[model samples]
Target: MYLVYYSVEISNLSENKQLSCFMHLQVPQTPTVIPQELNSATSTSIAVYWAVNDGDAIDCFQVYCMEELQASKDAGALVEEYRVTVKESHCILEDLEPDRCYSVWVMAVNGTGCSLPSEKAIFKTAPAIPTINAEDCTVCWDTATVRWHTSSASAESFTLEYCRQHSPEGEGLRSFAGIKRPELKVSLEPNVNYFFYLRTVNPFGTSEQSEAALISTKGTRFHLLSDTAHPALQISSKATVIHLPEKTKFTGFPSVLGELLPARGCHYWEIIVSACRSYRIGICYEAISQSSVLGLSDTSWCMRCCPTQTSSLYRFLHTGVMSDVCVTEHPARIGILLDYSGGRLLFFNAERGLVLFSIRHKFTDAAHPAFALEKAGVLTLRTGMELPEFVKHS
Candidate 1:
C-alpha cells in the first residue's frame, strides 16, 4: 500500500546567515548482506531465515513474497508483504499456494528509513488438502460461514463446494470456484442440513477434498402480515425488518402484525428489539380490534417494555392492565409462544429464557404475531414462520 504523508517543511534563506540552531538527523546504517534461506516449510506456510548486522539501529523488518513468474521480473501485481518489529530474525509466510515456488525478500526498517532488500530466496511448499474447523463453521437465520486456516502463501485461490447433506447421489454439490478469500459466506435454506468442503488451488494444482463440515440454518423465518402494519411503521420487503422513522407523526396506531395466524398446535417465534423507547410484542386474534392499543383489547395478549427516566424494564399488558413484574436490565430480544388449542400465551426474555409473563386465554379465533413501537425503533424477525395461512385482519 502506498502511504500519504502530511509534512511541513521550513526553508532557510541562503542570503541571511544568522546564527540559529539547526536540527540534524542520523539515518540508520543499512543491514549487511547475508545468505538467505527457507526453513521449516509447510503446505500453508514458509519461513524466511536471515541474519542481522551489528551496530545497526534496526527497528523491524518487512518481508515480501510473491509467486514466481516465467520471466525474471518483479511480480508487482501479486506481491504481498508483511511488516513486523519483533526481535526475531525470521518471519513465517502464511496462506500461500501449495506445491508452488515463491520468491521472497526481507529488508530492515528503522525510524529514519528502510534498508535495501536482501537477495531473493526461493521456496516451494508441500501440497495438502485443507481441513475444516468444525467449531468455526456456523449458521444463523439465513447466513452461513465456513472458516479454515492454511499456510498456502503461494496459492492463487480456493474452491468451495457444498450441498444439502441428505441429498441423493448424482445430485452433486454446488461449486464456487476461484475464491481468493479464506472465509466464505453462503446463503442457505433454513432447517436444512448442509455439507461443505474446500480445496486449495494454485498454478501448480488443486488440493484434495477436505472433510465436509456440517451446519443447519434456523428452521423458521417470520414476516409481517403486510397490510396489517400500521401506517406509521415501515416494513422491509420480506417483512422481517420493521422500522419507525423519526420526524413522523402517527394518525393511527404505531404497530405492525405478522401473518400466518394459526388456529391449532403450539407456535413459537423470536424478535430482536433494538433502539426503542417503548415497544410491545405478543400474539393476538385476527379479529382483534386495531383501533385501540394491543393489550387493552379482549382478544390480544402481549408484553410491553418501556424505558422510564431512571430505569428500563418490561411487563405483561392485557385488558387495560399492566403486570407489576419489573425487569431491571433491558433485554435485546423477546420470544412469544402462542398455543391456541391449549389456551396459552407466553412471553419471555429470548436470551435468558426467563418467562416475563404467561396468560391462559380461551382463544377461539386464529392468532397472529403483534408488535407496537411507541418510539423510533427497529424490530427484526428472528425465527418461526412455518404455517399455512388463510386469514388476514383489516
Candidate 2:
C-alpha cells in the first residue's frame, strides 16, 4: 500500500551544527636543562674525568692537550685517542703525569659518529694551592689553629692574621709574622667578628695569604669532635687572581693591603689561596678547579682566591658585586676574632668536583659553629680559628 509516502527521513543535512568532540592536545614541556661541567683529574699517571648527564649512543671522545689547543705550554697537552663508549659516566686517560696540566673534552659519537664537544675542562697536576693538614678554629671565641706544609722544607716560618676582609698586599689584617710553629693558637674577642688568615713565609715574600676565615665571638663553641677527614691538606703556590668584570657593590669593603682592579665583564668564581684555604673573587668558567663542582650553577659567582698562578700586586680586589646593590666605596673592616667549632670551607668549581678544606677544632672547650652564606650569597670567610657573632656588616 502506498501508505503515506511522506517518509520521516531524518536526513543528516546538518553540516556545521554537528556536535563534534575534540581534544585540545598540547606538546609536552621540556625541563630547563643546563649543560653540566665535567669533573676531571689526573690520578697515578692516568687522567680521570667524568661526565654528569650523558645522553644515549655516545660514539667516541676527542682529547686535546694544551699544545693542540694552543694554550700555555705550562698547561701541557690534551689526551688523544681517549675515545670510549658511554657505558658509564666516568672515563679515564691512562699514562698521565702527576705534574702536568691538561685540558680534556668529550664528544658524543652517535650513529653519525662524533658530535661537537660537550664541555671543555682545564686540569693541572701539582695541587691547586698549598694546603694544610689540620686547620680549625672556634667562632665568637678568641683563638685559631693553623697547620701547613712547605714546598720546600726550608719554609722557615708562617704568618697569621685576622681581619674582616681579604688583604691584597702581603700585609693583611692584624698581622702576625714569622711564627716558627706550623700551628698557632691565638686569643680573639667575644664581641667582635673576625676573619682569620695565614701565609707561609720563606726567603721569598710570604706565599699569598690564606683565605679569610669567618668567625664570630660568643657563637658556637668547639669540643673534641670526631675527625672526619685526614689532617694533612696540600698547600701550593699562590693562584692567579681573577678580577670580576662587575664593579664593586656599594656595600663592599676594600682591601687595606692592596688596591682593587678595574671591574669589567666579571662575576665570581672560586680559586684556592692555599690548600686548606680558598678565596672569593670574580672567577670565570675557564678558571674552575678540576676536582669538584660544588656550588656552581648556570648562574655566575665571583671567587677571591684558590690555587692558581695569580700575582700578588694584581691579586687584591677593591670592588664586589653585592645583591641588589653596587659597592663603590669601601666599608670599614672592624670585627672581633674567635675560633670555629666544626665547620668546613666549601668552594664551587665548574670543572672540578666540590673542593673542601677541613679545619680541625682548635678550642679547648666544645666545638663552636660557624655561619656563612649570610651576606649576598658569597663565600664570605675562608680561614679562621673561631666563628664570630654579631657581624658589623656594611
Top-lDDT candidate index: 1
Encode model 2's per-residue lDDT on 1-394: one tens digit a residue. Answer: 1111222433475764544444232221211112223223322222434543323344344444431333434455544543444443445554544334455565544344444564555554322223543324322234434445545343556776766443357764687786887666666644455566666544422345566555555343232222210122111122122222233353323211111111211111122332222333331222222222222422223323323343211122223322222223222121212222322122232233322221222223221111111112222223322222122110
Q: Give the root-mean-square deviation of each candidate in angstroms.
A: 20.3, 28.6
Q: Report how far off residue 315 is in candidate 2 (Å).
A: 57
* TM-score between model 2 and native: 0.24
Pick out the ten consecutive residues of candidate 1 with the lowest summed lDDT. Answer: 385-394
Q: After superposing candidate 1, which stretches have Cα over 4 Å from the reference?
A: 1-220, 385-394
TM-score of each predicted structure versus truth: 0.43, 0.24
Instruction: Give the worst 10-residue stretch by lDDT in candidate 2.
Output: 257-266
Candidate 1 on 360-380: residue-level lDDT in tens? Answer: 778777667788888887888
